[model samples]
Target: MILCDIGNTYIHFCDKYRIWKNLPTNIDKKNLQADIYYISVNPENEKKLLKAHKNSYNIAKIIELDTPYEGLGVDRKAACLGIDDGVIVDAGSAITIDIMHAGRHRGGYILPGLASYFRAYKQISPALDKQINFGISLDEIPLDTQTAISFGTLKSIVSCIKETIGGKKAYFTGGDGKFLAKFFEQSIYNEMLVFNGMQLSIERALKKYEEKK
Candidate 1:
């Protein structure tokens, strides 16, 4: 089976053997043979994919997660579904931090991603426009401008995450997941974390479908 996570910018596809990404418009031309189980944040792209693949199933319609946060993004839900207990951080265009314990979502928050932070700095002033110094030591006071900006941004995020999780394990995913995961000693970086949740949701959905048959 094929599992797809469609975002505004790209469609991430995962099969048993491999994973890949492509433009939303190009998905129809891939000629995939397996049924697709997907969760999408882009409705227009979702409609296009549904029309193109008759066998596609939207996991959003099938999986019911325990959460009180109204209108939580499906991508966040899918990431949280894979674990019973931990802090889940998806570092994509935006960073989402969620707390899940014993199969239930406690709550979560969102922060501007690394790129967004840099863009915001650029908007403030050209002098402030700089890339994040991922290697900067957060424990030391930065003497340089670049290090100052990086420390301020990365330190705030890391501190907040550490406080929120309170020593629990962290599960990181998405584009910058590995980078952020490095800051946490008790963290696991899995690129396929969302897909793993999608797989589990698909299994539950299939069982429900069979029961109603």
Candidate 2:
């Protein structure tokens, strides 16, 4: 199965291409074939993807997430569905922390990603311009300049999570989640959590389909 997270910055595709973000049109199905295609993309990309896949794969199915809450991130919603409670920290191109309490999703936070933070620092000023690695922790923050900018910023997020929802379960996902795992020991690595949720959604939808039969 192929699961694609059609994100704002990049489309995350899980096929034979493990970490590669994008794929060329020439790629053969046997090389990177998919049983089902699960996606949460906007209408704009949806049209293009549908048109592209129309003639190629007879077995693939694509789904776009629709909920009562308009403009919600499908990634965040999927993460919330995966975990038991507390917060879901998705450290990807965009860092989003979603809070779920007592089995109910209660929304969360979205902010600039690690790269975005560094990019803003580099673009905004000259003296403060420095490349900061995403791997560094609050204590290992090199100089006060980058430390205050990077660690303090990340620490602030950590503080917010501790203060708001400490006791509950924590789920870490996305590209940067594992790197930032030191601070949050309670968290677990769930790379396919979103894809699994997408699969679950398919199951639910199919169940509904059977009722009509």
* Cα RMSD, each candidate: 2.1, 4.2
26: Cα error in model 2, Å = 10
How many steric clashes between backbone atoms does each model show?
Answer: 0, 0
- Decoy 1 TM-score against native: 0.90
Could you give candidate 1's per-residue lDDT for residues 1-213 as a string of tens digits? 889999877888898859888777887556468998889999998887887788988778765679999999989988998689999999988889999999899999999888888888889999998888889998899999899999988998889888987879999999888999998999999999889888888899889889999
Error of 1 at 54 (Å): 6.1
The window of 10 residues in a row where model 1 has the poorest summed lDDT is 23-32
What's the TM-score of each model vs. the native? Answer: 0.90, 0.76
**Which candidate comes out best when scored by TM-score?**
1
Candidate 2 per-residue lDDT, tens place, 41-91, comes to 355554444554553221123233333445667666666664566677888
Best-performing candidate as measured by lDDT: 1
Q: What is the lDDT of residue 1 in candidate 1?
A: 82
